[model samples]
Target chain A: MHSWVDGQPVDSVPLKDRGLAYGDGLFETIAVKAGQPLLLDRHLQRLNEGCRRLALVADHGVIRSEVLAYAVALGDGILKLILTRGDSLRGYGLNPGAPVRRILQGSAPATYPPAHGVEGIRLFPCATRLAEQPLLAGLKHLNRLEQVLARAEWQDADHAEGLMLDMSGRVIEGVFSNLFLVRNGLLLTSDLSRCGVAGVMRAELLAQAQALGIPVVVADVSVEQLRQADEVFVCNSVYGIWPVRGCAAMSWPVGPLTRKLQGIVRALLDI
Target chain B: MHSWVDGQPVDSVPLKDRGLAYGDGLFETIAVKAGQPLLLDRHLQRLNEGCRRLALVADHGVIRSEVLAYAVALGDGILKLILTRGDSLRGYGLNPGAPVRRILQGSAPATYPPAHGVEGIRLFPCATRLAEQPLLAGLKHLNRLEQVLARAEWQDADHAEGLMLDMSGRVIEGVFSNLFLVRNGLLLTSDLSRCGVAGVMRAELLAQAQALGIPVVVADVSVEQLRQADEVFVCNSVYGIWPVRGCAAMSWPVGPLTRKLQGIVRALLDI
Candidate 1:
């Protein structure tokens, strides 16, 4: 693991990193393919946007260059970027001009989730609900206890992921990925303006579907709507996309839309 | 700082500690006075309840012993108790049987907000609002970006704390403390069952208020409500109760109720 405190390597962070204190940080996980970070520009864009929203500095070019360097050294692995509001003397009030830190760390030979891309996978409808707060929504910050607790609901390996519902009982997304369902030729996914991660892969798929003339609807979804959908799939930057074969007992047949999306992501990432 | 992982002294934690990853952990910042923890039992109760909500673990005696042993030699300072579901192979999913790790770090004397328990404070209403999610509303888990971002809004040392409102513009509390207002003999504040921190001090004040025959109403409060308030104050475990002299342009006076509550807290913590 490599880290930079105020842009310099450090043995340990001051125990008061806002990231650990109040999760006052943003992160990005990317796939390192053939010494290249897949969707590097897009990841940097999101990271920059998050920092901008929080009024933190955005050295887009430096972050992009540094992350690529770390990924290339690993040959083939996962790259994670964590940018935090450095340290404070003590208290919730910000110390103007406090140095910010960037941490680039991950393991080599990133293991993709099962061969479910070909065989498809199952999902469980978890009882845990994702909380909605637009101020901290979309951007992937470290405040992920909701996801951690939701994912802990069950440990069924067969179920590749668990579907999380929002406080309104609307199906939002999966534990670590975004959910999409095709019904009557329209692609449906939860709106991240409320809850759920705005996954880079999910964004890519949305653009691809728009170019393909497939209607994409971003709104609330009920369990019944998911059960009646023609097909379902969950996606993330790492796993590309995995078709949902069965949710509990209801099953999906891996429709044309699902397969096309998988192919598009593969071509985009050259996985 | 003294620290440990799985009972052995460690230099740093795996970057994947759920604590740093998702704030998928519970923590208690206790005031260690005279080599002993102040309000130890109360802090443990809150930590235990948070663990149950996240379904982590709660062997109170075990954690208590660990904290005491590490804090015995320490004089006046603060002890942070971070309990995270031990390491997992990098996923949001929790292993029900995952070992829980305790991180006990020490800090030197605290420098609290100036004018504390005295001249009162001036606050700014922050645009970043806390979301009302009854499930994770009160527990002081790791998911606190909203507060951190709000706190980062300014650097005016004399400005004191920032007031956080919900998305609907309803006044919630400060970035770190529970707010209380006295108006026409009634002490009112926002309810934590839906949003805001259930500060350890706030809870004690409620019980003490009942004993003193003070009417403490926990309900939704708005900016207008605060403007009409006669007196206002904020409290947390470490800060006891600090009166509010002004909020941006609107001003408030320190009332008898605010002083009475602070007197009770001083007697309790023996500050």
Candidate 2:
């Protein structure tokens, strides 16, 4: 892997980094193609919001330039950017004016079966329900044991992802992706105010759907509501979109809405 | 600082390690005195249980031996042991049969004001509530952004620790310690089934209280109940225990029960 910390080449991160100690960090996984990072602005925008919410000072200009330079050098792959509150003593208290550490690493894009996009993918209804924390919701901070546990729920290749729900039994998102339901031609997704990540692709889809004149509603979505949906899909910035074939007993066909969005996402990434 | 990964001396951890990437790990902070680690058995026991809960394969015997060897060499200090699911690709999915990474780091003990133990410390009512996550609860996993945020709520040196409540408005714990309330000579603490760390010190206190013939109750502790209590205190393995003098509008006296436990704890560690 090619890596850098705060623009300096480094083999590993310091053990005392707050990111490793308390998961006190924000991360972005960008899909790189032909030496270009897709949706770099969106990723940085989210990272900026995360820094604001966490009350950490971040130099977005430096982050943007560093990420672009790093990705361009890598040519084509997946680039992960982790911004931590820097190393601290053995306590929760933050060191005054601690420098923010920006780590950029690149890896080859993971190969997935084409069928995942064409024929859609199966999802496990993960027993690990996400806890409602509006304070930390929507930010792609490093505290992600919930997702790790939910993803570990299924080991079978037949299940491409796991569907996670909130404690109140509301359908939240995929283990690593944001969820969307197309019911009667309207784009519906869970309100992440309570829990779940609001992925970059999810935000793009919402905006694109509005531009395409497809109605969108950001509100509470139930399991039964998902079951009744005409089409279901999951999306992430790295993988684009994958139509949901089945989640537990409820099976979904790769509907026209899912295909249309997939085409748009492909074009978006290809650029 | 002295550090090691997988029994080999190291200065830093790989960025791809799951502990930094996804907080997929457990940790133990132990107090060492005169070439002896206080509560080595309890820390390892908790780590083993955490491994079981997370389904991560751990060699507890090896961990126990290494921790003791490392601590005894250091003699008197604080030792932090991090057990991660090890390095993996950039995703929530685990690498099957991946070796678990054990990280041991030792640092000098933290110095706090002597008044904090004798006169008690002030507490801040944190707005950041602890999310109810039973699966991840009670385990000192790396996912601790909630506590980081809670600890960040106070800038005043007067507030030694912030008191955090759950989403349901029930008092949970301090940002880094387990909370207890003494009401009518009975020790009351929040149940860890929903949320909160089951600190080794809290466990030790419970056992010692029972041995001392003080009634103990592990149940839901509301803010109102804490206000009505005669005494309130917080305990963690690293700092022993600190009595709570004030939180919001409710004030507590450093009652007899708290002082008794403090003396016993100091004796337990000193020997």
Candidate 3:
């Protein structure tokens, strides 16, 4: 995460940045290595579409240019880009005329989960439920209290993730990633058209699955269906692919397809 | 407003404040004058409950003392107090071991909506729909993009507020305040057990009406009901009572009961 604000690095942001005020912002966490941002275009595209969906103004070309310049200087690390609607006189109503702010702060050492693309992760079903709001389903806005609470449900750092369910106990996604299950010789994942982050890696996994000619079903899933799966895995742009094993009690081994997907993504990183 | 972090006026906070990260925070905007905060306890109660619900660790008395000290220094303005889960290492999980944060920052020159409590406001139905999540129903956490986009539905300065509907097309709340309508002398407002802010003023109005022998019903309302109302008004602790003159060409006047409630709130404010 190279630090830059509107193209310059700043140590602090105004406390009242609309991101703070209304969670009125978009963010993209890109995987970085050696010194370059991976899947940069995909992250930027989602960020732009997010801004458009919320009617926030940001020049994709300008932000992209700045990100590249900033990353080149920082060497290897993850990049987290946060763009907020700048300070406005206190009000819920938009200052349609207000300038949207760009907060490019924090360039930290990029570290992947130690078990990533290998031994995999363990997840527990969380009692905290996510609301179904299609308007906010896919956009990576800053209003993330649900994820915070759901993740906080467990204190064991060994558990890498928590699978959140909606009010009806329908499976949604991991706290930060999308979920996929292999059952009955088919590939299935929860549809995020209602509530969850539309992760960049999840998008790639879907595309690659289609290219592989696998049977993929995007629909509502229940805990019962998840429990009966032969294999399970979670994915996000930063983590790439992580198999899920022993979701508290049920266990799953890293499957063949999960490994093949990981190989292609690894090749991209090595490139 | 006076600026403080855990009772001290700090020059800067860590860039990693949870309020900025996961928006793991809660805030209260109060109308203050003559070195006193209006309905301070209600605001404090909401903030305290939010902190507990979000698993944030903090002493309530400390927050009370800090906010009071800051409010006393500023004779008039809006006091915005934010209690966040505080800064932590990278993860969606809460910092169970992290110290809580209290952000007391606002300008003393700030005033409530000019037309809100005086001449009332005009509103229009918003197209953005809120999702029903009982788990997150009324706590005013920082996940407010739903309201942000709804508030952005228009940019007219004269249009003081916009009324929001749930995905089911049921009327819920204004962008910030609670909604109320009068029909046949019955006081009606949207039930927020599923959506919208459980506003401080709305609670007080309910209590005030109950004490005054007026009937209050928390029920599902529709646009037609709003359009057919004899009178309409919106309220929040900051702006006591704002009458609605029109909502999408439907005209209403300041109802007799609304004016009476306004007088009651004004009396309390003068205290």
Better of 2 and 3 by TM-score: 2
Top-down DockQ ranking: 2, 3, 1
- Where is model 3 more than 4 Å wrong at Cα? A107-113, B8-12, B108-119, B222-228
**DockQ of every model listed?**
0.59, 0.89, 0.67
- Model 3: per-residue lDDT, tens digit, A196-246? 888888778788889989888989999889889988989888767788986
Model 2 regions more than 4 Å off: none
Q: Model 2, B152-237: lDDT tens per residue? A: 88899889998999999999999988999999999999998888899999899999999999999999988789889999999888
TM-score of 1: 0.91
Residue A6, candidate 3: alpha-carbon lDDT: 86
Interface RMSD of each: 2.2, 0.7, 1.7
What is the per-residue lDDT of model 1 for residues B138-231, given as tens digits with 9 covering 90 to 100?
Answer: 8988787888778777677766788988867888899988899899999998877777777888878888898889888989898999999999
RMSD of each: 2.8, 1.3, 2.6
In model 3, the Cα lDDT at residue A208 comes to 81
Correct interface contacts retained, every candidate:
0.70, 0.87, 0.78
All candidates: TM-score of chain A: 0.94, 0.98, 0.94
Candidate 3 lDDT over B164-239, as tens digits, reads 9998889999988899999999999999888888888888889899999999999999989988998899888876
